[model samples]
Target: MNNLDKVKKIVIEKPLKLDCGKTISNFPLAYETYGKLNEKKDNAILAFHALTGDQFVTGINPITNKNGWWSYLVGPDKPVDTNKFFVICANVIGGCIGSYGPNTIDPITKKKLATNFPVITINDMVNAQINLIDFFKIDKLFSVMGGSMGGMQVLQFVANFPNRTKTAIPIACTASHSAQNIALNELGRQAIMADVNWNKGDYLNSECSPDKGLSVARMAAHITYLSKKGLQEKFGRKLQERDDLKFSFDADFQIESYLRHQGSVFVDRFDANSYLYITRAMDYFDLVKQYNGNLSNAFKESKAKFFIISFTSDWLYPTSENKEIVIALNAAGANVGFIEINSDKGHDSFLLDVPEFLKSIKNFLDANYKIL
Candidate 1:
């Protein structure tokens, strides 16, 4: 095959013991690949996805009929440059889009796992990925890159497989969530549980699903993805259709309409129980604690080149928070590069049409990946 480009559904037979003392014998993972692995097996790169993202990192998404989420950065001539490296993106263990989550069929019961699914952590997620990487027969990944929750996985990969990753790029995320972010996630879950049709995460057994609750949750979480300046610049308290206030509770402002649309469309695609499982995984991701409260020790064995990026207006994961990681990397005496791009787009800037950010990524990937 000129390009090993396709989605692969794989199952690991060996039991993987999670950090929480739980063990799973057969874990399923969904992954997509692009370009071809060199005969030397040194050109493979694994790209992690954000909280709601899937393994469809490039090309057309069959379900959505839209371009892959990271198409801007991962195509043949794009920043990641598939012409040079083989890229693989795997859906996280607790994700719903074809991965083993609440929606997966439980062999024992012959039914969906639902609330019965095992609680997964970021460490568990990376463990599953390590299995997938082993299946690909690659001794080491050339680089691993991701942003937001995906970025959390990148750090987890480095922490757990220090020698396996040659280059690590974590962008727009913290090693752990702040109390405030945890609170926001809690609010989303509460919204879902409050719906009568939730049925405590077993809604699949019933005719009713918590569509409304899930929509509200998505609406709430979507706001944190943008900057205050971005919100003002895009909507700015502007009235929707009438150009004047509607006295009733209808969506009078453009931002309200925008959020409602986002929520509605999200509910059509995502499942409520899957949302709960994945968000809980993100909340429990704490790298420093995994290394006994010393963040530097987490990277003690990391020989990978590190390039960390953050956005200036991203309050969700502000530059100061990202610098904590950079400082820790320095303490570990690792090769690292840190940059905070000045942007009004906030945390979503990495996904948007930011020229400077894209340029920086292109430069970083080009410099870090040297042909062996």
Candidate 2:
């Protein structure tokens, strides 16, 4: 078996008290690693995944039979360069993929937690990751990197554990979700719960698992991931399958067909309850609140070098949001660098094959990180 095939499964028992006042025991964190940790354990890099992403970072996901989510940016010679740095990617605490999620069987009830799974926040996810790092005996991380919700975790990590990281990179993310963004997430949740099969999020044993509702939720959110120009260019008035519009309920526009496919495929690989939990966690995130309402105070004691990147077209969390983070870091006297990649791909550009994005990362790591 290759290295990816030798993947190990680890489950960290949750502590009695979580940051959110929840008692979660037997918390499982599913993760995978590429390359090897050096003797000093100084070469470790923690790669945080976005809202819908799982532990599969640079290899194929055996569960879904699909390529890893961020494979474009993480291989042997890619920007992350697994050949040198030991990369660790884990599904967040409320995630479904092998992690203890709403879908996991609760030892007490002998059934999946489903809707009973305690509410989790972004801080809870980062705290779980900190536990994993502690288990690995990695006292400090060489770098912590991510985008979107992943980027939120990156910032949370630095704020919560300033001494544990050497470098921090949060891409295309905001310190807190805007009211409009929160409203969008709420609508998605409402769509899922609106399905009669939802049964208050306890639909694991139902005949059909709210697939339609989840599909609609995914479709709605996926629209936010792309730039308006990208959507227009990729599929505007173009008809789907047929040259002429049916003008009925059938999908006529190519975008509708594309979104339908996205929704259908997403349902197959993701759990609706997990989606609800993760999105709620993201919506509850506000890093500045823990810092006396001063965003800069969040990084007052940080020693990590910071790299914040944003895309011009990502209105979901535009460049201005990134600048706010950069400004705070600067006010705190933290060493920081900011870059805005000019792209029409919107928030998803970082995950796609963007040469300049990769180059920026490569150059940053080469110049600052020591290779041992």
Candidate 3:
């Protein structure tokens, strides 16, 4: 393959420290890049993926045959404009795609780690990202952006490597995982564990996949991504096909059918154990609590210009939480711009085609991230 068409992969063969007191070796990360790095190598943008997201950010997903998740905003002439900036996105650690995760082979046992893989925290994922950045010989990122769990990673990156990023955009996220967030994740985990097919996370050797369990988990979590208003507008007591109820145990309403479809399709491209590990990593994320419960102290050293967005209808990561981060940044004396986007798209507004959100992102990048 030509240099421009290269598929990027990085291997950390040496032991790396983790916040959980465990050291990992031979950690592999699969990433994708768009545009090109210039002579100065300072035009790179690092994008972090959400819980179930992989490395494909702006290309056709080989397995799903669908456009990249954020293709609307990351391509040439788009909001961030890949034609102007070199964009890099890696599948986070504890993810199933081409990256190190619970389903991968363990060098020591010569078998898939399955349930044996050591638990990882969000900080550990950022540490792995640092290695990938170092391998590419990039000293500073032009910008870093993401939403939901992706947003959490962006916050951690700016906090940990303050001066390394010129700008930070974290949408629909908080500086730390709220107690309600942990509860929601726990609900999904329970649904997975309750499925008999899970077989205690050892389904790999048994040659039996936990499709039902994983599907149920995805179904439960998908509901949290939308707002009550959005849900009502989309499928409020609407019947599936016929006007009358089936009077059976099958999907009776439109909402039920949608959730089932989401669950089934998710299991096709995602692993059950990987979901467990990733959600666990998110649940353990609490930046302020980690720094003695002081929000100001958490972002005191951040030098990146901040632009935070939140949806008015997003109950998962409400507008209030987004402003809390901005308030702390203000106290820390960080350059910041924030707006509460008026949208009914809920926490998934950042992923949807919201004109206001797009305009705001484009204007922010144009102002803060200058491409020369």
Candidate 4:
């Protein structure tokens, strides 16, 4: 079998019993692996993907026919250094890319889940990943690293299975979803559901899917992923492919064109209903709540060395939020390091080519872990 076929073959059906009290039987989780897990399984690194990301972490994506999202940091000689560590990136539950999600058929109903899918949470996603790890027979992960929504998963994993991780890194994430963040996600959901073409979440069987609404939602969320300064630097009143402005509703600025392209391309590979479920899951995430509303208590049992990173311009989950994580780790008496990198890339900085971030990660791993 080819690489894609191998990946497909590894999918585990009925990964877990979701938090919603629903059993997702015969589910599939797509993942990609690099390097080999040593006999001791000490070289394994679990890399989680952010919202809109998939299992294609270090190599080209066969399905989308595009380059891997984080190839810059996870190559043969890069910071993740596939040559030394066994890296595994799995599509989170409620994800559309070969994973159980709203698009998955309900065996009992004999129909696609659509809007009938159970509401999932970050805890659910982390729990499913733990199952996968157990299936692989990995007693412990060398590290768990991620950014944004992925970072939230990292936090959830550490909180839920403190003994399973040797090191935990959560970059550009919050301990819980802020009210403002929840509002933003709710607005996006509203936009998608409001579209007449949505057909009350049954757009899959409709003549035309809710592309316009989904595109608008993507455009809005994409703005939060970028920094104001970055946007200004890249496209400050610049004309769109034309010297003269149309004065019409057409995309007049370069930023508008860029956002349009992002939205259009996103809808082609993503399911609108899946987007709703996953974003809602993120909005409902609160790691502290599980520990009696005390963030520090959540980490009290964690023995992993923690590295919490934040970008200066990431307003979505500002430096303040990362500091909150640091404070909790400190209170828990966990070995922790915190860094706020100077960057104008917003929450997307962790995924982008940031030299300082890469350097810090490399140095931290080198000093602490035995990289084979």
Listed in order, each prediction's TM-score against the native is 0.96, 0.96, 0.96, 0.95
Per-residue lDDT of 307-358 in model 3, one digit per residue for the tens?
9999999999999999989998898888889999999978888888999999
lDDT of 2 by residue, 1-372 (tens): 023334455667757355668777666788888888999898899999998998888777887777898899887888888888999988887887777778778787888889888889888888888888988899999999999999999999999899998999999999988888899899899989998888888788666788888999999999999999999999978998897877798998899989999999999888899989999998988887777789999999999999999998898999998899999999999999999998889889989988888889888887778541
- C-alpha lDDT score of every prediction, in listed order: 0.87, 0.87, 0.86, 0.86
Q: Write the per-residue lDDT of candidate 4 for residues 227-307, one digit (tens) a residue.
A: 999999989999988999898999998999999999999888777888899899999898888778899988889889999
Q: lDDT (0-100) at residue 199 of candidate 2?
A: 87
Q: What is the lDDT of candidate 3?
A: 0.86
Tell me the deviation in Å of residue 363 in model 4. 1.4
Backbone clash numbers for all candidates listed: 0, 0, 0, 0
Ten-residue stretch with the least lDDT total in model 1: 1-10
